[model samples]
Target chain A: AQRVTQPEKLLSVFKGAPVELKCNYSYSGSPELFWYVQYSRQRLQLLLRHISRESIKGFTADLNKGETSFHLKKPFAQEEDSAMYYCAPTPPTNAGKSTFGDGTTLTVKP
Target chain B: SAVISQKPSRDICQRGTSLTIQCQVDSQVTMMFWYRQQPGQSLTLIATANQGSEATYESGFVIDKFPISRPNLTFSTLTVSNMSPEDSSIYLCSGQTGFETQYFGPGTRLLVL
Candidate 1:
């Protein structure tokens, strides 16, 4: 079975500090990983995808196939960065479905 | 990027009632999906809304309980039947033009009493 694990359910950080949200996955086939964020009073939106090999809103995640990990990181946290983040991985089910992690609620304190 | 919209952004209903959520995409899309997020839980895919055909439901979900319709490339609907306290959740709709990424709609929040 395909599974994504986000160890932290809640993370707090002071503004201007670096932040990292760890994510691990278990899948036999080649995996596609992505990060989705949901801000307060807003719908879920894709922050970035490893396949894109790019950064968005200063957030970047590299797919470490050897370790089966895709961790989202940002250099400087801002108050606007506070949101619920999910590590989503596409399963090999050929169903166009993605399995999302439990999600980490990030709170950036000013 | 595709923009998606959902109708009746939030609704509160009594037990034994039903609610049909609508989804529309700004551009044509090849795939549409329905998901449910219960309080304090992760997003769970309820089914894949297939155009011009019946929906494909995931395990633990059934057509009898959550009927779905996708009449065209840019539109779909999900009906949550026999509502109960357990059915109170945020229902989300998503669409993708290609296989790479999916754009999500503003979810419909349902509260069953």
Candidate 2:
């Protein structure tokens, strides 16, 4: 069974401060991880993926296989970055099915 | 990525009635999945809609309660039968275009009273 755990339900940070949203997963096989963001009154959209090895909106996540964690990080927080972030792990067998963790609401205070 | 659209962006339904949500994709996709997101909760996979065949539901979901149909590669529908207050949630459809990343629809918000 694939499971994703996001320990924090809410996180608040000051503008220009670094932000980190922790995510851990339990899967037997090589896992594919993703970070999804949903803004207020907006649809959920993909923020980044482990396979891409790229950063978007100054946010990046590195898959730590040893730790079984893929935490999303940003160098500096901005008010516009406030949103709900979800960590998901794709099942190795099912291409479409993904196990998602309870999202963390990020509030960037100006 | 596929451009997916869902009809009835939102609705307020009475208990004991049923609501069918429709999902349409711009291009052909191999896999289409339905998910439910309760208020302030994580997304839950409800079923996998396969073209020309019956949908494969998850452990906690059943075909009778949440009927799904995928007549073609670009379209699918999910029907919530015998709705109750507990059934109120945001229903989303996602499709994978032979890729590891899945694209999602806007989602249908159902409020059962």
Identify the runs in model 1 with alpha carbons over 4 angstroms from their true place: A91-95
Per-residue lDDT of model 2, residues A1-110, tens digit only: 77789999999999999999999999878867889999988888889988889999999998899999999999999999999999988754545467889999999999
lDDT of 1 at B60: 99
Question: Runs in model 2 with CA error above 4 Å?
Answer: A92-96
Give a tens-digit lDDT track for model 1, residues B2-111. 99999989999999988999999999887889999875568999999998999999999999999999999999999999999899899999986565577899899999
- Show pairs that collide, candidate 2: none
Interface RMSD of each: 2.7, 2.2
Superposition error at B87 for model 2 (Å): 0.8
True contacts kept of 2: 0.47
